[model samples]
Target chain A: MDQGNPLVEETASAVSSLSEEVVRVEGLWKVYGRESKRITSDKYSQMSKDDIRKKTGNIVGLKDVSFSISKGEFFIIMGLSGSGKSTLIRNLIRLIRPTTGRITINGVNITKLSENDLLEFRKKTFGMVFQNYGLLPHLTVLDNAAYGLKVRGLPKGKQYAKAMRFLETVGLSGWEDYYPNELSGGMQQRVGLARALANDPEILLMDEPFSGLDPLIRRQMQDEFIEIQDKLNKTIIFVTHDLSEALKLGDRIAILHDGEIAQIGTPEEIVTVPADSYVQEFVQDASPAKVVTAGSIMVEPEVLLYSWEGPRTALSILKNARRSGAFVVDKKGILLGVTNINRLERIIENPVESQTKRIDASAITKIPSVSEDTILEDLFGIVSANPYPIPVIGENRRLVGVVRTDDIFETISPNRGDQND
Target chain B: MIDFPEIIRIPLRDWIDEIMSWLLNNLETFFDAVGWSILQVMLGFEFVFTHIPWFIFIPLAFLGGWRMLKSLSSGITFALMLFLIGTFGYWEMAMQTLSLVSASVLFSLLIGIPTGILMAQNNRAESIIKPVLDGMQTMPSFVYLIPALMFFGLGRVPSVIATIIYAAPPVIRLTNVGIRTVNPEAVEAAKAFGAKRKQVLWDVQMPLAKPSIMVGVNQTTMMALAMVVIGSMIGAKGLGMEVLLSINRIEVGRGFEAGISIVFLAIIIDRLTFSLSERTSQNNQSHE
Candidate 1:
């Protein structure tokens, strides 16, 4: 993995904590209908969901699904309708019991729990948001947000105080007294989000929470949700059919096909290195320019000019490397500016440089630099207007790599063509 | 087909009669306690409805209509309808009929809602109760009067019992349907939030089902009012008694007066309850 950038390194470190599993599923299978347990054996293992359904009159909702989620990870389960993404999410909370499987949340096997214990476990461990905004039509916004707390038997004053805080977090402070039907679709989902957060459960399950909102509002909500997730660091298992949404919001996405996982990887891997044709086709419509970051495409410069180096040395290094320009950096590799052979040649001819005996500040040209995390779509204007290669800056303005306009164009062209087709 | 049916005939009526006789013989005390409680509730409602002067009742009806329906014209219309009932010379009888209908509806809701909730919660309970509800609804109103009279012995108690049997089906069926059909997403959301089964019922299902349940209540009230005339056949008194007396005496003008008064009362009650249902349902529509 390219852990050259701070953002990627941070995520890489977060992913490294395999020991801190918050939720784990092993061989989970959910078959709907009579004698569902009988179909989980090897006799039906080779058969497809439809074939098994025809044979035993059982609808396979999820088939041998297995995965684990780290704490504070944003895991997305992406699939079309009937692909069992919803079923997987419901099974995580044991809302829909698995026919044959084990689901261990925080090291406790929820599948083995009694009904009463499951209820108590659910109260403490899970908070769910639905696409339909599942707010009670009769309750006010504040009451709806406070519902999870109220159901947990929290005191009225404490419940409202926590609910009020979460309501404000989701930007629904002034709308507390309004009923759900009185709000717009976006505001209703905010209340749904707030209600889930008010519980402060270990896991937040969202089933296409933005699917009901208008497209523009959906984007706005996704942005706000990303910010909120960053702040809260709650483990969220989000289910959505929207591929771009998975790419935009998910730290890692598991694409489900026919009740089984087709592929599970980070968005860049899913986009650039699809595990199979199914995943490739699933990600076919996703625009790479929007998902591919500068760090992934940028090339580390071979010839780097140190600011202490004289203009003669800078020009000689650029010449030997067959490069027209070089990014100028301090000894610590913090990006100062860009310098070219022409500029260095002009500096060597000038007597003003001999007094300092080093490369003059005027020899380096200040051009725009982008963080390694900036997506290619955002780099279009900056890369197009600049004459020099854009420097890829990391944490504390350290120059890690450089992105040429060609890199952006090369990364997006095939994906754009695929989208057009 | 050639007089061969006698051997194949089923003794359903005899069986029912035998069961009825058995119940009447064995459960006398149970029947008496039930009858006495129903009679007390009916008498209490009758006392209040009859004692309130027409002057005070009519204004109160106007105010209730105005507040509930939120229209001055509706208030005036309600007062006018009650005034017409008074002019029909059956004001006290109308109060008696009102009390009977109120008592029947109250007991119907008490029995029907819980039964509905049970049916909503359990598929087996629903399947068992559904056919019984269907029988209660489809059986002729006169069929229950006989059993009710046999059980409670021909008076207001039997009349109220018969009216409850006649009218309770809609509420039971509608309550079952309402709770069962409450938004599944809302129910799922409640469950996901760790709400217990009881919390899911009261917090989400019951509130969402309010409009449908209110409609059921309206239907029950209307059905209960319809039973009043039939209830008179078994020695019950009210506008129904007047109608029964007019029928017995062959007095067409007097029957018409009583019938018109019943119609006036139905119109007022129906409008009020219908508006109540409408208001509840309208509260759920998107104001945005």
Candidate 2:
């Protein structure tokens, strides 16, 4: 009952206030034929697979995608190219109509809108950013930024002011008159960001917007996006092929496989319980403990040992220490230290000061401990912070058998050669 | 020589001569029909041109030049210089050539873009049209006027008809290329945004494809301008006629002036049209 830290309290409040549904898509289907015949069945109607292929002559772009984005959630849809991740977002915008499904946005079926109404819907509702920058090659940055407003018949002066505001926010204030080709890729994406923000959309749709940039710049942009989204709080649907990116940014992520949703959960959920075999392969290569919650690895009560004894006394003092190793807590029973047997080996077998690197009480980043309730992706962030091993917490904030980085990989992907070995 | 004058008046020879006459007449009739179509096009063009105030067209030309060319002042000045040259009585001939070139380019765009669109929509159509367009473009420019004159009898009509074929390839080429090069994702984005089919074509596709379409228009106009002087060789009456008359009469000053006039005309038209098209898609770009 100690609500001590104001910053942590604020974060909890912010997260708790988020609503459950911002976008509800039910049974969404998009079939793109491999051949040239266009798919002509009404996209809103239910159709059998064979019937759709017979009519459209196209391959499946998406197959029965169903998910709802909660407000204040950074929902990432991740897949390799052609996995229909982009198609899912595009269908939400009605940029590509689904072969069949009910896509409800703000409680209205956007699929039923007429052309004029739809244009208005787009103008008023959401903003889009593209990977290519898609900037008009001719216009100055200022003009390009102001394009949507002009197209929507906004008066020149006000649109310019609004564009200028975004230009400043995206850090392109002085270069507003420069053309796109004249700028670097990162700068171009900044302008794209500025343009998307100019409309103050309720939802921001970005399609690999940072994929084309240099790695360093890509990371920098991701950080910048995180900062912006923190303040803007818009429901964002980002599509990317980079797994690391999906883990970093997505509050919840949906893994796509061959036109279907492989798994959808908080990064933690997918990382831990990966819904399908494809998802397993995807997450298997990464260090596993980073993705598994403490609930999965916490030691049983009978196995618990209490003390801050050195690593050398492991055999005599702490029995059933187990291959996973142990965490040391003080008399007050607070987590004070951790040790992994396999990761620790002394130079002359002087095992006391072995590979045990003391993690200061302050050293661990205060992200929540992985729990059954925690998504697998959340553990990844914690594990990534410290590669030695992770401390597992159980009831009464007691030290539990540490989940060795090795054990995590073994749990998620049992097929590999003995991870502990 | 063999005292066979009467003997040589054979029936086979007579029949061969009669056949030659009949074939010649049919050939003449075919040419005549072509010539008449050319005449109608020219007459229609002239009637349209007569309604436009010269002042308005010249200013519009300047506006287009300024729009397309990056250099606005230079474009307007060039447009002004061309107008003055015409007013100093290069006017009639320049207008004559303009009328024909303009008509040819307009029709080429009208015909070529749809053909290009059809081709873009279907590979079979592209396959069929490719060889024909290639042949039409590659045929000798002089060869065009021969058939033109055979039907229209060496007048403006015949010259314009020839010019249309000569100048048309650009519009078709640009239209097809532009439509094809539109970003698939942008179109997909639009569709996902709930954009209708026509909406994808117009808002997402066409706006994205505008720069290419413009390049096509620019090329079409340049080709049309090239053909106009050539058109003048068959009594088309334009700057080409002025250049031709100057050369025939050995008046160097007149020919040189007309040649300069043509260059000025080209610069003006090219710059104006390009700028207009560029301004069409200002916001799509992520960069300045």
Candidate 3:
């Protein structure tokens, strides 16, 4: 299985060691046309995009932006149209040259390379999938997929073999001879992806690759893309305007607004704690239930008791917590079930000398538990059926935390900061 | 009567005439060399085309049509049409005219395609060549003969040169438009894959522009055939000269026979080339 494939196992941990930065951009700025340098100068640095353009007749593509992408991370640059997300991605690959910046990919400062050197660098270091599919119309699917390798001066036999393998990986094995125009939009983009994958570059740069697809196909493609990324575990920098897509696919997402980075964080953090009003409003329409996992909202249960504890002790613990029910777990914290005050009262009525004998096994109610990774919405039905808190379990079914009904309600409701935005 | 004033007499005609005469006088050797080389190629085509007997040539034409258009019926019909030209006793003249048209089309394609590709690549070159192409296409066909006559003298070479000038513009114009109009995304994709400029032009642009270029070839061939009679006015011999002689002697039967033969040849060439272009374009689309 491509999932946990051994080819890239080392890359998963190679990123966090900051010295191993795969891609880094510092003080990047791109202004279109002749006045780029003038517009990015100190005097016009603080101006808005429109103001700078009006003053210097130069459209700012990216403002003084700086970020570093770790190796093997699915980093997303997300923004609305004209917000310069596309420009930033293109600049990283040197497709659109930045007016002022230093871009270091795999520790080589690509921004300083000559034209011939840059072209050669791009051939070896980057593979790009475009929104338009960018498949050559005259070439068949296999030939189109093999194009990158062909231009790199690979032998024809090996090119075709690698192309066929990638095509199979992309699930287009049977349609190798079909041309771009004959295939539907989704299939064409798959060919585009396969073409990039055949190059096997260090990073895959995708710019709105699914935006041109139909909604259903786009959704399916996104899921397939995530699956492929899981298997390949390549460093990917995906640019999209869709917030949901960014949240779903990105290990970390950077939000760009008016040529500047608004915020960058994990999907959960971006949704729950936006950096500013602009980011708050940007995430207002995103469904929090989908973005917020059970782990994010789960709290440590205050009224957990060991099964070895007697009924008298359980009653006292519940009384202190002001809860009618208390969750019982074994030594390793595996959830036994919920034991309430009523069950403890019955055990107390028996009044056996041995506390273990007095405990009523039949009184314990076995309620459904949820895993830490379950989304908030999936817990809604399970929570409404029982009054007890849902135990959040981890590996080996050990209790980690509890998702109370109140947590579900509070997480779904819009944040107080969102209202101010 | 409202008459324009002639206060600004530029003497443009006299200047052009004097320049033309000076070029004719000074570049006689260079013109002779070019004309000699061109004449050799023309005679080569005429020898190959005219030497083959009618029975053998008809079958060869049938095979060409069949292979190109992929239709046996069209091939047979094309063969029958050639037989009709032979029955009119103008087969040799028809072959002569075919050779002339073939040479014009070949040379026009050889020179025009590269020039068109250059124009497509460079904006400055396109700007310079566009007006020249317009002049070449719109100027009267007869006007080209004067330059040809001065350059090469009245003969087969001069007639062929005149025919080339009249017929070559469509190929050049269409080739430029064909390459220029290729989808920019395809070119960008090629470049993104690390293809050099020359590689992109050959591997991507040319294949995509092929249908348009073929259409240009068809139009150029038609125009060349159209210039045959005009070419006969400058000492070229063919069905066109037969028509001219019959008209001068007032032999209506002879003129009619020759004219019909020319029509038959035109239909054969047009149908064959047009179908060839159609077949290739369909092949491209079907794969898609």
Instruction: Report the lDDT tens digits of candidate 3 across residue range A283-401.
Output: 99887887788877788998888877777888888888898987888778888788998778777776563346423466578888877667787888888888878888776668889
lDDT of 3 by residue, B175-274 (tens): 8999998876677777777778898899888887888888899999999999888899998989999999999999999999888888888888998888
Residue B248, model 2: lDDT of 91
User: Which has the better lDDT: candidate 1, or candidate 2?
Assistant: 1
Please tell me which predicted candidate would have the highest lDDT against the true structure.
1
Docking class of 2: incorrect
Weakest lDDT window of 10 consecutive positions for candidate 2 chain B? B186-195
Q: Give the Cα error of residue B240 in candidate 3, in Å.
A: 2.9
**Model 2: per-residue Cα lDDT over B1-288, one tens digit each:** 757588556598689667656755778777677566656776677777656777877787666556556667865796687777766577666666667877777777878878877776678888898888898899998876775665566777777678778777777877777878776655544443445566556665666677777788888888889877678888888788888888899999878899888887777777666666666656445432
Residue B183, model 3: Cα distance from true site in angstroms: 2.7
Off by over 4 Å in 2: A1-18, A33-58, A289-421, B1-154, B184-234, B237-288
Worst 10 residues of 3 chain A by lDDT: A1-10
Per-residue lDDT of A411 in model 3 = 71
Q: What is the Cα-based lDDT of residue B61 in candidate 2?
A: 67
- Give the Å error, residue A16, model 1: 2.6
Can you list the residue pairs that collide in candidate 1?
none
Q: Measured against the native two-chain assembly using Cα atoms, what DockQ does each of the candidate structures obtain, in the order listed?
A: 0.64, 0.14, 0.40
